[model samples]
Target: MAADHVDHHEHHPHGLAHQFEDMAQQKESVLLGMWSFLITEVLFFSGYFLTYLVYRTQYPVAFAEGSHELDITMGAFNTVVLILSSLTMAMAVHKSHEGSKNGTLGYLIATFILGGVFLCVKYVEYSAKFEHGLVPGLAWHPHGEHSPQLALFFSLYFGMTGMHALHMIIGAGLLIWLLVKTAKGTYTAEYNAPIEVFGLYWHFVDIVWIFLFPLLYLLGRH
Candidate 1:
């Protein structure tokens, strides 16, 4: 009986490590780590954006023409969807902080569904592009005004959106794991660092799309 009690106490201690003096310190540590990682990610995406600016400047007409080929309606719709997902994700974190397990799970499911929807829309766009032979290096044959630079434009388009989509897939996977843990009550009002960290990541992904939508879809809309 003493051994079982000792194990229970060990498993259900306060939400701070021995090295950390309090919950605040532990939470601060987690937040700092996440922010630092996000900063690096920002720099990485900035490199891509810098490359985009240089190329767009080089092929202004071609880039403008290529941007018009993208489905503005679909891109706009995706922006709305991602914004909603970010809201649900924030709600998930808040609910976890409030000790509402069911609320957290529900919000997380909503976020996961929205993420999947974004990927599906991206698939539709990509499939149409592929059917039209717009993808570069794979039987690409442009028959439009931007024929010469269309390949370069498409290359960048694929590179940027593909990287973003990969992040969404990973985020969805993380939500699945969070869902399981929430179902099992691994996180509560006292300890919701995992979901909070994931929220940071999700918000980062959404912010990236916010930039992508305007640059890729709205360049020639006006």
Candidate 2:
């Protein structure tokens, strides 16, 4: 009987760890770690954005032409998809807070599906560009004016968006892992650090897209 009690206590969410006095402390630590990581991500992407700004100012016409060639419809669709996923992710966190395990799992699944849809749209857009020889350094040619600057524009476009997509893939994988934990009944209202951390990551990805859409799609749309 004593052994069984110890086993149950070992698995108790409130038991947590020696380092954390309570679940709230654990959640706070996780949140701080995520913010630190995101700060580094911001610094990393800043280099690319600065480069884009420099070149866009130098060759405004070429940048405008290249931007116009992008499929704004697809970009807009992806933006919507990500925003919806962010909402679902936030709802999942809320469900966890309310101690609704099933609701949390459902929201996680919904967010994952939305993320998949966004990636599929991205694939279609990229493939279309490849077929049209719009890719940089590989059969790229400007039909109209500003042919030379098209390559530079394509370079920045692919680099920035490709990095963002990679981050999305990582975030989706993390959420899936969190969902698995949720299925195993590892979270409760008193202990949901994982869900909250995942929410922070989802929000960060959404914010990145908010900036990306305008810079890549709406450049000189006027």
Candidate 3:
């Protein structure tokens, strides 16, 4: 009787939720939910991307001039940093599958740090734009021949990159929560769905930046 009771509590506490019949069912439900949320995010970003395409096509010269103002070196560095963070995030998921608490903590820490670094670099870039009076509305100063179109390029720049940065900030917050739970041994080989699901989110953020880098920074460098 004691053995049966212990098994019941064990599986209920960590392995399965009340709505789920078993561990696999719980994981599948959670993953499906995460994917559903991500699909909406894709739709959200797609609108911005489509708008950018339309405007860039209409104002090619102005957009190219705006792209020239961006620092490709810094943009490339952040791209590499996000790529490395994605690798670390994948490793963290792997460690969770192995039920290695310390391994998961270490990799999560690395990912958090990389995210911070990316945000810091973006801040520097934003500050430079502000100093140069490139920001739209507040202080409009355009060095390009097409002032109106040049402002449009910067408007799109901040709108897209700012949203991406906000996502990174939110991801960083999630990582901190994961780190705390991981340290407490909340996840194990049999029940690591949270970590795995978060991996999908982190990967999506990285992929968005991959697209942003080329579209905003390398659009007309050639």
Candidate 4:
């Protein structure tokens, strides 16, 4: 009977560590985990970048022309949207830490909308490429007597950007999960580790775009 009573007491709400203590441990673990995951992400994307480098070195002119085919305006717009979403995600974390549940939800919703807008822009860009027959490994060719290296460029472009888009989809799913948790009052002024971790992920995605924009759109432009 005493052993059962002890187990019941241990399961009591306050039996858990205090919120701040929990937050500290949670933050440390999450930061470590996020950095570890980011290292893997860098390694994963590096293969695509290396392939692009090899092909571009082999056929500079074709790569240049292929790069020109990309819509800089659309790419720039998506960059802006991603940056804004990062900002909103940061704000969501901040609000969570401040115990402002409604504010957190609002920022999260804003981030989601921005993410949707980014996807819409991406869709338009991809459709244009499709119409131009720029798909990788399928119906891809340079327009109007361009270098065959353009095919290689398109291949890398599709592979890398497609992977990035997949990451964005994952990020969106994570944000939705965070939203659900937020609605459940899982985060509070004293306990918001999940928000911080999600912020790290969102920012990492934004950082990838920072590199991607320069590599895919701006390179060989001037």
Candidate 5:
């Protein structure tokens, strides 16, 4: 009976993994694995950015026009939204680390809500683009000499922003899971590895948008 009780308490107190003997080791391992995954993601996003640079250099006039079609106000607003979400996510991790279950849950909820707002803004932007016939291979009708180049620009535009939106969607879902777990008191000061890992992921997603905004929406505004 004592052994079973001890095992139950150990899991709660430390949240150890079968492969690790202690919480510290598990946290380090989990962070290493997450950082490795994030490094791969950075490379993946870099490929898209490189593509953008190549095509923009190849067709600066067309790129400028294409960038002008984007609503700078909306893009800037979403940028602020995402930045705020990252802040809240950081706070959530801090609260979780402090072992304040309600604080963690509140901040997670705030992060989740901010993420939803970003998606909603994205939806509006995409709808506006579709209405303007900005999409390629479906409704694009260029009014200038750079029609083909504009098509290429919009193609990369949709692809990159679309990929980023997908990441936000996934991140929001993960926040929901974290919110539930935090509410259940699954995370404590000693075992908040998952919260910390998810926080890093959230911050990464927002950083991608920070770059995307300037490239896609602010490039030709001047």
Candidate 6:
């Protein structure tokens, strides 16, 4: 019994939680938890999306006019930046699997920088809207037909984009924490659950932006 216990202890991966039977089980548990959390997130965002669709159907022209007020060029640039961040995030997870600490750190830093860039672009866009007095219920002064409907469009725009930005901000905070852990060599081939789970979250954020870009920036632009 003593020898058997010693063997089992040796086989156990580093960082395995006491409650988990083994590394595989622990990884599965963490991944499932993250997926479950993401499902809730999807539901949360769905409300906004549904509202946008319903309102757009009722006020198509107003929505289009509001979309035109958006800087499509900046929106497109941020989309590309976010897509690149997703790539880097994936690469970081791959490096973690390989136990390449330096590789993981480099990619994670790149992802962080890209995320920052996206947020900065969003700040610029928001600043412009504020300056132009387009914020609904705050400084709304739209210069076109259907002023009231335009306010509705801006309301949805801020609500959706603001929520997206909040998620990005949270992701950025997570990245900073991950970067510190990664730099300290906390993750490795036998225990990279955090990195993998975070990758899923980061990818979800990017996918949200993919939907948002077309809806908020490209809609009715033709």
lDDT of 4 by residue, 117-179 (tens): 888888899999898888866776646665466777888888888888888899899889989
Cα displacement (angstroms), candidate 4, residue 121, comes to: 0.7
lDDT of each: 0.90, 0.88, 0.94, 0.84, 0.90, 0.94
> Which segments of candidate 4 are over 4 A away from where they belong?
1-22, 142-146
| C-alpha TM-score for every candidate | 0.91, 0.91, 0.94, 0.88, 0.93, 0.94
- How well is each residue in 1-222 modelled by candidate 6, as lDDT tens digits? 455542355565778988888888899999999999999999999999999999999999998998899999999999999999999999999999999999999999999999999999999999999999999988877677789999988999999999999999999999999999999988989899999999999999999999999999999988
- Best of the two (1, 4) by lDDT: 1
What lDDT would candidate 2 get against the real structure?
Answer: 0.88
* Deviation from native of the Cα of residue 148 in model 5, angstroms: 0.9
Residue-level lDDT of model 1, residues 1-222, one tens digit each, is 455532223453446667665677789999999999999989988888998999899988888888988999999999999999999999999999999999999999999999999999999999999988889998598657768687888888999999999999999999999999999998979989989999999999999999999998888666
Candidate 5 per-residue C-alpha lDDT over 142-162 given as tens digits, one digit per residue, 9 for 90 to 100:
757888999999999999999
Q: Which ranges of candidate 1 are over 4 A from the true structure?
A: 1-15
**Tens-digit lDDT string for candidate 3 (1-222):** 455542443446575778676788788899999999999999999999999999999999999899999999999999999999999999999999999999999999999999999999999999999999999997777675699989999999999999999999999999999999999998999989999999999999999999999999999887
The 10 consecutive residues of candidate 1 with the worst lDDT sum are: 5-14
Q: Which stretches of candidate 5 lie over 4 Å from their true place?
A: 1-13
In candidate 3, how many Å is residue 52 off? Answer: 0.2
Count of clashes, each model:
0, 0, 0, 0, 0, 0
**What does each candidate score in C-alpha RMSD?**
5.6, 5.5, 4.4, 4.6, 4.7, 3.0
Error of 6 at 118 (Å): 0.3
> For model 2, how does the per-residue alpha-carbon lDDT over 81-169 read when each residue is reduced to its tens digit?
99999999999999999999999999999999999999999999999989888888876756666777888888898999899999999
